[model samples]
Target: MSSRTTDGRSAATTAALLAGPIVMTAGMAATPWESENEITAYQAALAASPDQTQIAAVLLFFGYALMGLAFLSVLRRAGGAPRALRIPAATLAFCGATMLPGLVVVDFYDLALIQSLPAEQAAAVGERAGDYGLQPVMQVPAVAGLLLGGILVMLCAWRSGLVGGWAPALVAAGLVASFAVFSGVTMVAGASCSVVAYGGIALRLRSARIPSSPPAARPATA
Candidate 1:
């Protein structure tokens, strides 16, 4: 364990590791489909079920927040991973944690656009926003961060002997489904994988032993 890590921080690290993915996956599953440039219908859906869309956005935000919060622990807990491996993984994870979650803010903004603007005007701004937002400039790092970074972290975890095969396997499948397949069913499936990957990590973290430390650092003492 690092010098700064305390029982509360450790617990939070593990909890965030598990909870972030669960909430993010739930958000993905809950996400309403974007219209196929049918701006009118898109507006209508937002009008009809703004709650669902907003809820998805909210969930996604928390997911990202949890992930970002878990970043330090992820880096620290890479266990026996090499610096070469750790650097890139940490970079991607950082980008994902910081960038991806904030994208959900766009969802709320979209909802607001729909609610506040005239139908035609909302569509115009929405289309313009989507164009700028989904640009590869933003997506590449975001995807690399959340998806590839996560995959690598688990790989590092496996390498470090911190976890077994299931953790890496689950994260791989989960990332592919959540980001690559990018559909509702796949999202749900990916979310299931998230549960196993990070959640499994948390379980392993609990079961694993810590080196001797001050009492405040060990929750078992608490």
Candidate 2:
């Protein structure tokens, strides 16, 4: 295996990594579900439990943001992760940071629109939303960053020997499978794996210490 290196530089970041996935999993588990119709799914979920839906959205917002922030610590210099690996991974994580958290506002918007507007009217508004040029502009990067960026980071971390292969596999499987699984049960399971993967890394970081800088050379003796 490649050389391993770690520096527990920030306890806060390590905590974030551990907590982020747990919160996200809670959000996923808390999320409501019903008919699979894309157009009406959010509306139905909101109807089933408005408070739960809102709470889940809030949790997701904070969770994804913390995950992004925690990822930054992975990119810290002299950490043994290769420059080539770290650079792209960090860039993707940054891209995710730029918009992933903001995307959660759409959940609130969906709730508001479904509650205040007539069903057909709200549906019409949603359909028209797709017609706008800005729709894809805002959504594409956000989803890609969260999904692709997260997966790549794990890949790089594993390849660079910052983590074991299981770390990447667990996270990647959870992430990819989460997209395929429609039920909340599977969602919770997927997020559970994420928690295990990231939280395990955090545990390691919690115990790690940075290498001390080189000491100053003594002056020549007379």
* Maximum-TM-score candidate: 2
lDDT of 2 by residue, 97-143 (tens): 67888888887887888898988888788777779987888788777
- Cα error of candidate 2 at position 129, Å: 1.3
**What stretches of model 1 exceed 4 Å from their correct place?**
1-10, 34-45, 116-124, 132-135, 179-181, 210-222
Report the lDDT of model 2 for residue 59. Answer: 92
lDDT of each: 0.75, 0.73
The superposed Cα distance between candidate 2 and the true structure at residue 80, in angstroms, equals 2.9
Give per-residue lDDT, candidate 2, residue 108.
81
Best by lDDT: 1
After superposition, which runs of candidate 2 have C-alpha atoms over 4 Å from their true positions? Answer: 1-13, 207-222
Score residue 171 of candidate 1 by CA lDDT.
71
Shift of residue 4 alpha carbon in model 1, Å: 17
